[model samples]
Target: MFPKTSLHTLFPTVNFTEITAIDMSVNSDFFREDPLHENLDLAREKITKFQNKYPMSLLANGYLEERAFYNTPNFERTLHGVKEYRNIHLGTDFWLPESTAVHVPFDGTIVIAHDNNYHKDYGPLLVLKHETETAPFYTLYGHLSKESLVISPKGKNVKQGELLAYLGSEEENGHWVSHLHFQFITDLLNETENYNGVAFPSEIEKWKKLCPNPSVLFEEEF
Candidate 1:
């Protein structure tokens, strides 16, 4: 369950007023031209160009935005004997450079610190279990570098704003551009190492309850 009060005061939150917000949704100008359809290199180039436009500013994509970036077989799924695609993102992505520092947003215990070594996988993933008064929930950090595992190992206790990890390179981060795939999970559905970061558009309402928007913790209104 989510916290009753806003988590913004818990730590210094990012105001999008300072950080630039990039539209990676299907309606965005870049993706509207033509689908990349598994051409991650071109997608990275476009994303890099957007970030370079506003030098030194962090670029972010908000939660629940439907994106076409996951065009590979990795995002395909079967439902009711029919094929469906998982394109609706469940978290907010902060596009950053490789090795960019990522910090914890809350105090929690490291439940998972493992590398999922498959293509389009969360190369270095960390899941932290945060206990609230209502119930225990989890936060997931994906696309982190190898050094993160060494810094925050499983079962380790971490504090708010502590250095959690660094953004992994495209080679290490599921072959996508460097970014932090941050998500909030009310339940892991018995998962350990990783959790579904995207869902089928048809079942979005169901997944939304399981995974709330990570932006609720941000001071900047979404």
Candidate 2:
């Protein structure tokens, strides 16, 4: 079984209280209206501008919109009959610049940390393991700087809230705009350090089977 509890219980220094919630209502004055109805484009533009001005990655660029639950795009069907473009995000994104220090939220062994060009989804990534008395769980840090993995060897144990890696930028981070895509997982499918946390609208049930809400562990209500 997976452990669904506050990461703070394991790492006292991870201060989720300092993290702010991002509001994603379309009715907000900050919401930009687009004639093309390409909300993602408008969102990306606004977030990029905000990121340029803020010291930390501003929430404007990559905040989760509840509409994502229903606004998934449609594309050619895969062999599994799953729409290729309809993956609803199962994790929250933190759009920050490259080299943002990624701290471990809890003590765990580095299970997997590697880079691959397979889909370019998460350019370079790291997955750490955490075990509690009740269950074991894992946390994934995506779009990480190349140097982040260079310093830490696989199987190394990291302390709670310790500096794990720095954030990767758009250039090296799977060609997407800068951000850290973090997710919590219960079962890793017998794979170390690599797992897909995103899911097509049709695969929500499958994703839910593999990945659970990370917010439960973070305990920061959005």
- For model 1, the local distance difference test gives 0.78
Q: Model 1 — TM-score against the truth?
A: 0.85
Q: Give the best candidate by lDDT.
A: 1
**TM, every model:** 0.85, 0.71
The C-alpha lDDT values of all candidates are 0.78, 0.61
Model 1 clash pairs are none
Worst 10 residues of 1 by lDDT: 7-16
Residue-level error in angstroms, candidate 1, position 86:
1.5
Residue 85 shift from truth in candidate 1, angstroms: 0.5
Off by over 4 Å in 2: 1-45, 48-76, 79-86, 118-120
Q: What is the lDDT of residue 112 in candidate 2?
A: 84
